[model samples]
Target: MRINVLQHTPNEGPGAIQSWSHDRHHEMYIYHPYQFGNLPTADETDMLIILGGPMSPNDDLPWIKQERVLIQQLLDHHKPIFGACFGGQQIAKTLGYQIGKAPHKEVGWAPVYRQTDAIPGIPEQVIALHWHEEMFAIPDQAQLLFSSDLVKNQGFLLGDNVIGLQFHFEPLADNVREMAVNDNTYPLDHNDLHQTPAEIIAHGVPAENKQVMYTLLDYIANH
Candidate 1:
């Protein structure tokens, strides 16, 4: 199957998802809209994975609007989609949810409390890489899957095909470092959800989130 990933920046890539695809021998492609904005037709790819980034959904960029229209097209065609962090917020925005400034910025390895599951592989609680300041509300008819102290809508499942996760369960240690490097404006002054750089750098483990990511990918691919 062809898995196309939409990347907003050079730093953040498909991390563990890319590893999963390689393990399964699935063909993968990446589209960097921040550099050159263009999208593939529905027939080109079997599934889409929207990756994390420093950008917010509220930004009024031409590329964002174009991506929104493309998202609608994918939804209309009943294509499967997996969105992470900023990508997740974009999906909620496409579904008519109000996405804007979050109350707090969650960076580093944070604990996410799972409320429910559409896929059985996800545990009751998982620590994922969190790096975003924008939050999203669950769209109508979507099942709420997870939540954290900083963000209420951590994850949501829509129409058996689309899934959005506000946290980064797929980022590897190298991916995390790259993400940290790109993001210069860390809100350290705010007491809300700000962790020091040393703490984030210390928690390094690529193997931690790989299996769960593989399980989720298997579920997404088969179902």
Candidate 2:
């Protein structure tokens, strides 16, 4: 499978998704819009994976708009899209959802209440890494797949081709460290729901938890 990853920062790489791609021996092409000005053309992309970033999708920048155009084209083609955090906001914007600033920043590991309508492999509740301050409204075409007590919209499924997650299931402990190094978000108790870096790492990345992430990616690979 040919996958195109839209990365906005040097710190945020594909992480576990890269591992999954390597494990499957799938072809991956990444485009960094933050560094170079060009976003990848979705022509040969079987699936598009939008990674997390610190930038807001609502930013009025040429590159951001350019990315949106690509997103629209991919949506029209019914190509699969898996987006996290900022990527999720971009997906929601392209889908006509209002992206708003979250009252509190959710930075740490948190549990999401899985909806009964969730796809296979997503348990009733799962603790996933989160780091974001923006929330997107659920598009009418999409169904809410997961919700947390703090954030109502955690994940949504819009057709089999598109899925958006507000948290980072792609990041593990090492990935978290990388992000921490890039951003001065340490001292950990950034907010009430925020956990310290040590706490998050202590929990570690569970194999089963990552398998659930792979399950979602598998859907895009096969379906």
Candidate 3:
């Protein structure tokens, strides 16, 4: 399968997702619309993985709108799509759902409770990385997948081919470090939910986190 990634920033590239694709021997490509204004059409892409960024899906940038159009095209084609953070918000916005401010700017390792087994293989509860101030609202037709204390809508599964997550399950230790170094004000403000760079990196991407990510990828691939 030709799995294309939509990367909004260099630091937020596909980490575990890339590994999963490689292990599966599926072709994967990353596109940077923020830097190169390039994106793959639905016809050329068998599956699409959208990564997160600091930007909002509600931004007024031309590429933001263009990305939404491409998302719609992929939806029309019934292509599998997995979106993380801002990428998740893009999918929500494209589906006419509201993207609003989260109660808190969750930015560390936190436990997310699974709401349903609709997408099987994920545990009932698992600790995942969080780093977003805005959250996506679950569409009426989509199944609520997960939830956290800071964000009620942690993830959602739209139909059988689309999944959106509010947390970071794809970043590895190096990717986490890159996120901290690249963003000057990474933590934004230290709080109960937000942890220091050291604290966040110390945990790294746990084995279970990587397993759950691979589980999701396998589910998407098989479907």
Highest TM-score scorer: 3
Inter-residue clash pairs, candidate 3: none
lDDT by residue for model 3 (1-223), tens: 9999999988888999999999999999899999999999888899999999999988899999999999999999888899999999999999999999888888888999999888778898999989888999999999999999877899998888899999989998899888877763767575448588777777777779888999888887787
lDDT of 2 at 95: 82
lDDT of 2 by residue, 45-136 (tens): 78899988888988888988888899999999988899998898899999888999876678777788887454776778888877887898
At residue 85, candidate 2 shows an lDDT of 88
List ranges where model 1 is wrong by over 4 Å: 187-191
All candidates: TM-score: 0.93, 0.93, 0.96
Q: How accurate locally is residue 25 in candidate 2, as Cα lDDT from 0 to 100? A: 93
In terms of lDDT, the best-performing candidate is 3
Score residue 104 of candidate 3 by CA lDDT. Answer: 82
Error of 1 at 187 (Å): 5.5
For model 2, the superposed segments whose C-alpha errors exceed 4 Å read 186-190
Q: How do all the candidates rank in terms of lDDT, highest first?
A: 3, 2, 1
